[model samples]
Target: MPRTAPAVCSAVHKTDPDRPRRAADGLNLCRGCLKGMHRNLSDLPWLHAEVVTSMPTTRATGSAPVSGSRTPGLPVNLRAGELHSQMGHDLRTIAGWVAKDRGIHLPVDGRVGSVCAWLAKHVNWLAASQYAADVRGVLTELVGRAWAVIDPDRRPMEVGPCVELVDSTPCDGMLWASVLDVGDPRPSKIWCDGCELELTPEQWYRFGRRYEARRRMSA
Candidate 1:
């Protein structure tokens, strides 16, 4: 038999049955609703358990459960101001030193609004700790470095061709060059300026052999 829906007070009459229903007075909520609410709460310490775990041990305060004892993994519905306060406190205590050392003067007002927004833009929140660490390392290297001063002409070590390849070979005299624009997970398109020909993988290999032979004969 289908169970009858629970009676809701007039104030909460507009709420859907599936969503978490709470008493108008904020007293007791349905068990299912409470669970859903708990999961959805962004302030829950468990949501950040992975982050907390990767933090340096020296930052530990009192050794109790990092989130709290009463609701170890439970979520807490925190207001925007409260969330900002917590983040500000953490960044000031932990990241302030590094920022100062790098001559990036973070505000001392204990409100991390600007800092948090900056971090959100650069770092992927869902990435693993090791990935985040690598990103931090890169950022640290960029400290005090002017973006405009960095050489834009330099190319990446790994470049790909724009077309498919069947086979290839290397010779001492011929350079294995790829198109400047192609990227990985895509085929490479290579052409030889000397022959004014678009060289397939096999043809490129032959060109390399001929170039090497000519070089050896000249020597």
Candidate 2:
């Protein structure tokens, strides 16, 4: 008996001619190309990649009747469906919080280029905290979410779209507020009652030292 060859990867499959999971895009991608693209979609630097679109069909096709028939975007690692999901926003919000918390400072944009640049620069020296002990862990999670969005078959973890700072007890709103002139007046914004007591004695001490250090830096 002779063996039957598998289907060729020439064009996008029928289920989704726009987005192909099991095949690679090209005039005719070989089995190797398909596999490589699949693997690289979730590989390292995947988090650093962005999904972008080409210009309108008129620019490329020289046809006016096909005005609405703009060329479909080809995303080797990005897709519309993936960027709009829980995983997509969760990773992005976490990046913002981590950057703000560590003073790395990446803009709160969903695009990967700028965020990845910031990640590249500060990931080495960014001090770990209770929220993000492992920087790589968060990066991995981010990549996982990106992969999940691009590839429907892969099951990704559930995530909150927005990450918030929560107190152990229910939030009752700010008890009081004060401002100090440390060269600049920045409010000591306390969000809840008893929130001050939630920190351990050591944590408070460390925080005090940091606050004083910043004050001195400003001075």
Candidate 3:
């Protein structure tokens, strides 16, 4: 015999008997419905999309880009807003400094508001942390998870790509962009134009060989 489903989510489990339980709340939700909810709430197009739809439309009107427009769109549901407010207040109490430093904004929208729900459940643990690193990690993890939901369409990082530096310096680590190529050479970080200037002859040759190997492997 099938186990009785919670009245709150009976319809949810009705659709899919095997829907994942998203929280400690014991409420089981249909996986398809959860994905649909995620799609509705987490699709913050403005952040990921470079080209704004309003740009050309506004240009046609002979006006400057709309400056006062609020950020793309927020989740319009009342429950989502309440959840965000609740999370904000709780975070401020336990991890106020970390939240402020990290700009902890809870992005919630649909039925699967599971991320927000999870954070709320763990607020007490996050607050009782003594180390700043642990607190920061929790906050960062929450934010990163939110982003993962918001922008699900991520391209894999390619071998030949530039990653930004953690800090900035006048002669910063190779002027801040880690120019990734075939050879995974260490950053000389000194102000220089070429490998000949940045590295010793032996270092350059050894690094070149490694780079070639990396290229072949990747290929």
Sliding window of 10 residues with minimal summed lDDT for model 1: 143-152
Arranged by TM-score with the best first, the candidates are 2, 3, 1
For 120-178, candidate 2 gives per-residue lDDT tens digits of 44432322223322333344455545544432322222211111122222222222222
lDDT string, candidate 3, 155-213, tens digits:
11222311222112111111112233356343322112101123344564665566567
The TM-score leader among the candidates is 2
Error of 3 at 146 (Å): 1.2
Candidate lDDT scores, in order, read 0.32, 0.36, 0.32
Whole-model lDDT, candidate 2?
0.36
Q: Highest lDDT: give the candidate number.
A: 2
lDDT of each residue in 1-219, candidate 1, tens digit only: 742232331111112423333322222322222222222222123223323333322223234444534543324322322433444455454345445444565555533444443344322221122233333332322211211111222211222222221123111111224333445432343342111234555776776566556556655
- Candidate 2 root-mean-square deviation in Å: 24.1
Q: What are the clashing pairs of model 2? A: none
| Model 3 regions lying over 4 Å from their true place | 1-83, 94-129, 154-219
